[model samples]
Target: MPNPIRDVAPTVADAVANERERQESTLGMIASENHVSEAVLAAQGTALTNKYAEGYPGARYYGGCEFVDEVERLAVERATDLWGADHVNVQPHSGTQANMGVYFAALEPGETILSLDLTHGGHLSHGHHVNFSGQLYDVTQYEVDPETGYIDYDELAALAHDVEPELIVSGSSAYPREFDWERVGEIADEVGAHQLADIAHITGLVAAGVHSSPVDHATFVTGSTHKTIRAGRGGIIMCDAEYADDVDSAVFPGSQGGPLMHNVAGKAVGFTEATTPAFEAYAEQSVANATVLADVLRDRGLSLVSGGTDKHLVLVDLRDSHPDLTGDDAEAALAAVDIVVNKNTVPGETRSPFVTSGIRIGTPALTTRGFGADELETVAHHIADVLDDPDDEDVRNRVREDVQRLCETHPIYD
Candidate 1:
């Protein structure tokens, strides 16, 4: 069947087709991205997008919400089962919004927030000066130990005691290791602070049991559905039943108006897919691929933050191996060869955020494309060669051909 949008709007259709082709042709190594199944794609494009479910299931302000209420209920139930949460809210627009929901529900304005520093493998929403969380709260930051490239729990505890924050956030955007959730929870309890664990980047791994979950250790848990989980694009909040009403209200009447029911349906489908044994195997392989890639890079003389990864990504700090090469330059060089990655700030970054000292490479998208250890090893070598001489046209051309071949070998959608 012909696409109705293509028949009506050729320009928009052309852009959509080009975007799909782009994804099919490139190696997506960005740490926070993954390709969802065609079922998820279709669900997000369904007629449910036209409906506005302004409230929770059976409590919506809008009429004709029977079907959408069922969709939202399934999303909530499947997510709760997948993550083992007491309550799940699948209404937030994005992971940032999900964090906002927690903040809005838990604290008043000008309260203190203790989180990891942005340049030290933390997220902007955690407490960056430009974000709303920063504007509304007194934000104090903790950093990784400079020598070990890992969070310094002693310093974090000390800072929490000194700051006496209302909330302590535990999560990262570029850190390449697992967090000690129980320890963090203990520190929060000692400091009399609420713990908000943002698992946005590793939602799928946590769901598949490849990574430890923070559901029991945290007062609230939030994640992005579309990362490793391969859900539709949106965020989800999980909390205990006691906080359920506050969280739901914060998500709906506080931050957003109506829920995107189509995306909720996609979440329901993706959460169900995550419960399968095949997905468990896939999550395991993704971490294995990342480990192989990390070893290959380290063997090639690249310095990895934390020395390696316990998850699906590895952060390459270019300051040691290539002092003159900025992360932006490395990102551009990889992009030239059709291997896409994002420039990121390392634990002890000395450069600006836009021109950082590191590049983050992930295995989730490539693994979703059916890549395993051997393929990831080859890709890692290609990446090393390009970073070794980013200005070399011959090297770029050779890697470009190999990347094309790899993409063709592990094609994504039909």
Candidate 2:
């Protein structure tokens, strides 16, 4: 059957088709990415996008927002249920914006913000000088222990007291261990700081109870709707009932207007899916697959940050075992054979961020495709082989065949 998109907008249609093919063919191992359901994809493409719901549910600047209000209300309810927050704002455009909303809600300009270092697994919004949070706030960055490759809560507490930050951010993009949220909360409390835990990369893991949640501990929690949650593209902010109004105003009139209601519907749908037992199993399996992959990689002589994983991703420090191979080199080598991973900086990295010494491999997307520990171990062995000899065409060809076989068996949108 000939599609109308091919007839009317061939160029756009071709790009979309190519992306679908690319996703279907490749092993998507990017830690902060996942393949969302077709239902979610359809919901985000609906006519709700045309609506202008500039305010919260039932309180809109524009008229005829009833349906969007319903969607937004449902999204909030589901997010609240999953995350156990007194209030949930499912309207930030992305994770960074969610962090911005928290900042606007809690801190005045020039106030201090203590957070993890970017190279030490912290996110950009946690006070990278290039970001709005840093420009507006006095940013103090912390790092993991140089020897252990883990956050030292005592050290963090020391820094928090020294800085006396107005807000202390606890979260990471590439950290492979679970944070002691309670300890962080204690530091924030001792220093009279509002704790904002941005679980942007592990929203699903936290929601599924695989990771310790910060709802009761932190003053605010921010997350992306997509990553591990499989929600349509957006961000959400969760807060206690006391800060609800401040958070709401900060998100709407303060930073953005006209909520993406279609994405809200998608978030609602994905939240529904996440509430099911199946999603819990998927979340657990993601971590298990990562654990297996880490073991296999370690057996092949690769160095993992923290020596293992407690989540759905592993950060491979290629500096020790593969001294000649930069993360960029390994990323390109794997991408050429359809195993997609991102170049990432390890703790105490010496190279440029663009050309990092480590590669971050994740299991969420592949786990979404039903790749279990055995399958993931096979994938890891293939990864080790590629890293062992990126210059060998025969090795590349063999791994390509195995990757294609796995993709064929576990289809993305069948």
Candidate 3:
């Protein structure tokens, strides 16, 4: 069948086809990325992007925004219901923007903020010196224990008390263990600091009840619509009703201008999808696949940070298993074999960020595509093999072929 859309809209069709091929050919192991549904993609490509809805529902800076207002309203409602948030702001363009809104709402410029260090599995927005969060605010970073590969809760409390930061951020890009939200909330309470949990990676798990939700404990929560949620690209911020206006204003007049209505519509759809029974099962399987992969890696004598994961991603410390292999080498070698994964910095990494000694792998996308524990075990072994021999072109070609067959057996869109 010759598709009319592909014939007429050549560029758009080519891009989508390329993406489909990319997904089919390679094993997607990135913890922070996912395959959104075609419906979500359709919404994101709609005419809704042309509308200029600068303000919230019933309060707009432009007319002809009634439909967009409804879309944004539906998105807000779904987000609140999914995460049990009191107030929702669905305007932020990215997770970083969502975090920025929280920062602008709760803390002033130059105020001290305590967060995890980037080198220790924390996100850049948490407090890297070059990021706006650190450049604008006095950021004091805390790190996980070098020996335990976990957060030192007592040390975090001591540092909070000593420095008296106005805000305490709890989140990570690579940390593998379940966060202690109760302890974070208590510490924030004691320090009179606002606590924000950036659960961008874990939102779907929390929503599906596979992991704990921090919305009830933290002053605010922010997450990306993608990742484990299988949503389209965008960010969301949630908090209590009292801080709603401040957060909204911070996102709009304080930082950005007009909101993307198409993205808002996609968010609405994604939120609805996340609340279903099928999504819950997918979330559960995602965690299960991660556990199986971790076990396979351990059986093969690979050292995973924190021993194993309680979430979708596993942090592999390659120092003991592949002593000569840097993270960059591992990522390249795996990518050559169609096993796509990103290099990450484990806690107390002895190497630099660009060439660190760890790799972050996850199972959400594959689990969504119907790969189970056995499939993941096979993937783990293939990954180990690829890393064990980076220079073998024939091995890479064989792994690529295997990935295509596996992906065909469990196609994403089907």
TM-score per candidate:
0.99, 0.99, 0.96
Residue 260 shift from truth in candidate 3, angstroms: 0.7
Q: Which stretches of candidate 1 lie over 4 Å from their true place?
A: none
Model 2 CA lDDT for position 162: 93
Q: Please say which candidate is ahead in lDDT: 1 or 3.
A: 1
Using alpha carbons, what is the TM-score of model 2? 0.99
What is the full ranking by lDDT, best candidate first?
1, 2, 3
Q: Which 10-residue span in candidate 3 carries the lowest summed lDDT?
A: 19-28
Off by over 4 Å in 3: 1-16
> What global local distance difference test value does model 3 have?
0.90
Q: What is the C-alpha RMSD of each candidate to the true structure, in Å?
A: 0.8, 0.9, 1.7
C-alpha local distance difference test of each model: 0.94, 0.94, 0.90
Backbone clashes in model 1, listed as residue pairs: none
| lDDT per residue (tens digit) for residues 250-325 in model 3 | 9989989999999999999988998899999999999999999999888888999988999999999999898999
lDDT of 2 by residue, 31-142 (tens): 8899999899988989998999998887899999988899898988899889999989999999999999999999999999999999989988999999888798999999
